[model samples]
Target: MHLQEWLQLLCSHTGLKGSESEDLWSLLPSLPSFSLSTSSLLGLGALASLTAYWLVTRPRPMHPPCDLQAQSVAINGDPNCRRSALLKDENLLEFYYDDIRTAYDMFQRGVKITGNGPCLGFRKPGQPYEWISYTEVAQKAQWLGCGLIAKGCQLNTQQFIGIFAQNRPEWIITEVACYTYSMVLVPLYDTLGMEAMVHITNLAEMTVVICDREERATSLLENKEKGLTPKISCLVLFTDFSQAFAERAGKCEVEVLKLEQILDLGRQNLKDPVPPQPQDLAVVCFTSGTTGKPKGAMITHGNIASNASSVIKILEGSFTFQQGDVSISYLPLAHMFERMIQLSLFTFGARVGFYQGDITLLMDDMKTLKPTFFPVVPRILNRIYDKILGSVTSPFGRALLHFAVRRKQAELRSGIMRNNSLWDKLVFNKIQASLGGNLRFALTASAPISSTVLSFLRATLGCLIFEGYGQTECTGGCTFSLPGDASTGHVGAPLPCAMVRLEDIPDMNYFAKNRQGEICVRGPSVFKGYLKDPEKTAEALDSDGWLHTGDVGQWLPNGTLRIIDRKKNIFKLSQGEYIAPEKIENIYVRSVPVFQVFVHGDSLQSYLIGIVVPDREVFVDWAKEQGFVGSYQELCQNPDVKNAVLEDMRAVGKEAGLKSFEQVKDLYLHPDMFSVANGLLTPTLKSRRTDIQKVFQQQLSSMYNKTAS
Candidate 1:
């Protein structure tokens, strides 16, 4: 019998028959044939509505679809030469500051805007930071400039003032003094070595050398005695000097004056400032030479100002600098990257606290200052990540930490970043407090950071951390990641002052048509040219004003740049395959057992080799796990330990999709780290490839001989 008829009869016999039941039976008969009952149909309708609501309210992607897939616009129908996808009219973004054309002008604007606000900061090892007001800084700068003039230093851009010091208030003061007086400032650091220092001083013909310590002044006098830098006529010491040093300076025919003396001279002489024009050379920044002599990059007032202004505009919506904002300065001022950062901070009237000249004390400085902004490199961030993860020893603690990270990452994906969530309050608050408990933004640059570390820190810190890419030639910034970008490996679109393009690197098999080639930058930020090296300048800057960066880059569909290889760092193997040691090193360094790695490839060989400095603690832990115990140095020589590390590296390389030729076929585990102190690393922590190779020549040859046997 039909179900509808059966239901109707059953209702009638049971004395349950009514108009409502009859209508229900009629509706069931008219309903489309289905096994689902009326209740099931109602449940399905509710589920569909919920699904529709979810579809509409779900979190959108961080970047637009076009940004994720579209190619940058090619210039003049040449796919090889492209600008950012955001540009349609092909015009670069204008400068953020309309009137500020020079760093001196920017500083003056800051003095007017922030007035008596804290400008520079200093502190003892254990004390809170002390601040210098903007007005005081301006006054000091003027006095110093006048003093320099009174000391017979020329009052024009031709006069080069050499500053040999770490990051300190005195260092910045000297810089501003140079800027305001139109004197060229040349920074000297320990990493430059005596030879490079002598080279730089003589090349620039510096008459005055301002140093923070007595030792620096003595060193200059000694160099004068050796007749290496004879043009150095005045020694200005920021610290108190001894009578013996004064005598030494007198014998060297150099006038010795204390910083206070210079200030007093300036106070008596009081001259008006001679601020430079836009095109005037602001600084002669020398690159940290890893293989050859350092080349001084002649950065103009407009080059640096425009770069800073462009960065400010790009980051204004996300990281607006305020008078109340404070930054810790630990990175070397000699490096263009840090100098550019400080310049931007000064432009916005922010406070900068100098670290205690020791990297180990950086966190203590941060804790005392409670800095609002942090500019860092991957090495430091990696250390922080390792320390934080290592501290959670308990299984429950690890689980909870992982859970919190996952939850926060989900929120990040949903376009919500919070420092007040339940997970944050319970788990990540402590982590945030370790970094001064007040960090609102941070930046990582100079090297690529792992996505795992980046994501973890983004969730734990509950603030924005941007990655930037540039060289000294471009005034330290070419491109920077957007504020909320969650992706990794790509340094974001070009800054407003930078017009970036890609050219075919045919030798490296990189083609711009394939969205891969050498990165070329054009715009106001490009340097005036390498100081005194026209041939080098011509090679760097093409006829069309594109500065060809030696970095090999692949353009992402999102119009972002991913630095893939170093065109100059590539070497051919016996099999005719090109191997980029830096590219392979970047991957193998991700192994937990590896702390620092350098991959080496010889043209005569068919395979690559590596010299790895393992993370001491982790390596020891693994050794103990394997029931072997020894001192770190002894274990480094153990064959078993060597094989284990090699295997771990292999696993990491495989996971990273490294080709067989790219993977290290043999490994040498070194106990000593490649450090700047050892002359194996540069001031920026980049490996001095030639120096490292020289240091490990014996090991390298032994490994190759063994492989051949």
Candidate 2:
């Protein structure tokens, strides 16, 4: 009860009205116990008032503060080198499950623990989500593993099983089955292109390919006809195959079978499982190849197992994974970040719901599942941030929104997190409801998110938004921001299995002594090596086992890591001023019109140019507001629209404090976007700069010539 309510109740029980209560209060000062010197009475009253205020206004933190001072310890008296606080003398973290060493082992443990609990979920067009229990999943995976063995797949660690499809129950089932039978799993997606797919298949010497759709299966046969993949002898379809398609496969000298057929074969001829050892090869995760051809990174069972276990150990104290926890799987399963998340969930027997193979329906899926754990990328978060801010059309409402955010952010710094506050109910409740209103935790990776967006989401969503940093070669994540950390612009300290240090990048003017240089990670979670490429392996992993990450970073005083620039993606202008296009592109993409931006600078030129793909909806809306009428393509080509977008980009750049030379002075607004499907972006959404430049060579040349003149 409130203080006023208590006082009123006391007065009613004592049979005293307001005036009578005031008289009693007035008499207390003149009572015998209060008959003291005036100075003594005044000092007692002051102390009581101070005590009451302190009791009412003191901070009530909800979670423990991150020990920033002890975040990492220097190694061998070198302040520049560091390791995780959880580590002891550089020893790697053990697996979360004592006996579980591989991904398949994790499923078995889940079956033993969660039993009939839902493991995988899917939704039909008009139905709610249907779930497959852990026991059922285990049985299906067993049958599938034996079926592959019966179908002439070698039961050994070197046997490569390729999966080329979107994320689904079948995709994960294939992955678990491959690990169950001591086979290496190679994941391929549409973004890899036909040439890269064929190259991966041949490089892995994969004899069988499993797919979800008919087009994917047909493409394999078509590629065979083109003499690209001669070794692939079998095609397994998760969906049904028509007799005509079976005949077509037979004519192409390839065997085709449905999923049910394989399960039946396995049921008829059940064999003992051949589990993989810790050192056995588990996956040949291929890089998306932003610079060159996709190279397979050989990940052993122990590598991924240790990585997942280390991550879980670090998070368990703050956000423990439980059986009832649910997550939406929408990010490409082909990416290591998503794969690691799924693996971690499996270890804890959590449920995973797959999207309907459509990213546009992700919010629909989230509403249906009401997931508690949300794993996202920065692109999705940025869109959500923009959409919510765009909804408040009035200046006063926007101002109020900003003010509310500031208030909540102040509470966040005091370690308080609550959603029932006045501001949360009035201003941010609807914003939270858009994400299913049950997001207890979220991890944003794959790219750096702005501090404004991160802090805003933390306050509005009422969840711990952890920022993580890693690469495919490190088996997913190496560093993750702490749970209670409110600071932004850093990826936090290293995980227990990862010991990070900086190496001098002399050309970039970054030095280890200055706590700024190329980030290098060394640990048990690092990949064994690049498959079939000794030169690249040697380049990535030095003799001391440190994986040299090409990104430049600075170690903050508190031991967190802040990404500064792209060491490998930087270029020099004619005036010898170095330009980092990625940093500029990141800033320019924040403009309302731009959806994707490719900032380009020529060493022969003094200024930069950009190829911008305007956000279709926002750009069209803006054009209509300006009294302009044209088709989407026509609007893109309109010189006035192009100039307006360029000006907006310049405004954003100026706000971000970009150098004059770094800002793009000329721009070509393209109607088409740089995407993975177009082979202009990697699967991770990083720009394939060489391919993008190739695609717009003529336009780039025109822009440069005009700027030069």
Candidate 3:
């Protein structure tokens, strides 16, 4: 019988909801479908019958109709890699099929579809995380948008809102509010020093600043008072004003608005829902330039939305997101990698938990949160590996783990055994249990991961590790490693959203037809250009709109891409900090008593190395003051003199406003200076980077080993 018919007959016979039946509560309000006045009124027999029928009658998990036009994508070297399926949307879930018009629109739709469902999970210090339902996020975002408009802040392209805060629920809420009001979001890294904060805000022409702490607010207002910035009208502080900045706050001309005050002011604006168009600028993200100035990348709403859509299309059924799936986010939202992934997961109704401010507490947060999805960097994964290795006790236990790891590695390489092994049940299961036994997948970016580490994590936690390749300009992902594609060397195949082609860089000995060159990308994911810097915009984004990534790449046998080298001098350190050697050298040579300086770095290494040629007079004077009775060459060889020079160099870097990651950690003082005659510098007085690296190869090696030891 039909559900309605069955209900009607049951009610009529039992007199549970009928007028003739004994009334459980006569004063209760009535509804047409059923009465929820009391749970005891519904008998166990009725509930059991209903549950049994529902379970048996529910539809099985089904695959969508096949697409005849789908093609195969190949990766060259790895035979274990399965031939990837083509542009096949049929296999995608219902969420992927929707043509997401705007970010705000998708957010509201998510709210309606997932009623009372957890969209965001937040935790306080010394407390467990509590789920914030979709309704609450939507309501709060709406109110926040209204509050923004109610203030002097305008809801148009002319208005730029600076978000100077850590990664938290409030950050996401502020982003959503920006989308609704069509205001451009200028994200400043919370730990970014004062100069960058002042530079970015002034360049973006931010009218209102929504910051989490008083120090940041004071920094912005102080910059204004110093005449570095023209004028900022409003300051929205998320935290209380501390005594540290209270004096500055009182003297500042800008009006202060509390977050709660804005919310209350927005209570009257629930119905004003003006969302941004796809073409409108959503963000002006500033990336550090090699010249010590920050250049803002203008990312539009369509750029971000399209990039997310393309990723979902390529990864369809390979990665599935069920409702209530918990995702623990540890990366900062100021960067595009974490920001775009958060939005994509949100659209599919996953519960996203933001990590607390302290990174050491990440494991504790994960234990309490029990996350199924984790977005990580290589450092985080390496730390977890270290922890696991430390926990292994006896030699016998270590041998067993090694054997199990080898067995799993062989099985994966051969593509023979797809089932879980006995090791998982006997030993590896403990790692899974520690992570709440639910970590299904993890995504890593910014740098390449060790294949050994990758295999160990896959075997230990039973989770797929997907590593991707892209710049901030590409909206976080251009090529993505697929499930079961444990290919070596290369990251993965290109997504349909962007077309990647290798352009010739003859100076670096790479060419396009050889299947390797400068990695250039062109698509909807590419940023419009560097904000307000048309010259740089022209150089990076030409007439055809292809972004010159400046990183050398090669294609694998199966059509995947690998970064072989970087033609550009800038490289990322192990901790994901970008270090431009030339930029550092320029700042140091001007202040330090150095005739010439050559900076070198390894992406797989944590710190920087400096090769210096100290000035003759300054070096002798400093040595004499320190009572070093020797010639300049002898003084240069002295360890004590080297330490003093290193301290002086560090002071130069500090005064020049370089961040800790950008500063030189170690140095080698040589008596000989770099000159054009020595083949280290060109006739134009530019230091030949490759030549310098080769000349001081031994010195660089010694410096690296000193820190390692």
Which stretches of model 2 miss by more than 4 angstroms? 1-66, 620-635
In candidate 2, where is summed lDDT lowest over 10 consecutive residues? 1-10
Q: Write one digit per residue (lDDT tens) for candidate 1, span 1-709.
A: 4445545554554454354345446656466654546776567546635544554444443433125344256668776566555455677654577888899988888898899999999999778889899999999999999999998988888889999988899999999999989999999888788898888999999989999999877777888999998888898989999998898888878989999999999999998899999899999999889868899999999898888887776666445888888889998898899888888888888889999888888888888999999999999999899888888989999999999999989888665666778888999888888889889889889887888999999988988788899999999988877755677778887776777888888877888779888899998899988889899899899898999988988877666788888887889999999988888888887888799999998999999998999987677877787777898998999988888889889999899999888998888999988888899888888999999999999999999999999
Candidate 1 minimal-lDDT segment of 10 residues: 62-71
Evaluate model 2: give its lDDT.
Answer: 0.84
Better of 1 and 3 by TM-score: 1
In candidate 3, what are the lDDT values of residues 594-676, reduced to their tens digit?
65678889988998988888876466766787677688899889888888877778898898688898888888989997754
* Residue 510, model 3: Cα distance from true site in angstroms: 0.9
For candidate 3, the lDDT comes to: 0.72
State the displacement of the C-alpha of residue 438, model 2, in Å, after optimal TM-score superposition.
1.2
Pairs that clash in candidate 2: none
lDDT of 3 at 306: 74
lDDT of each: 0.84, 0.84, 0.72
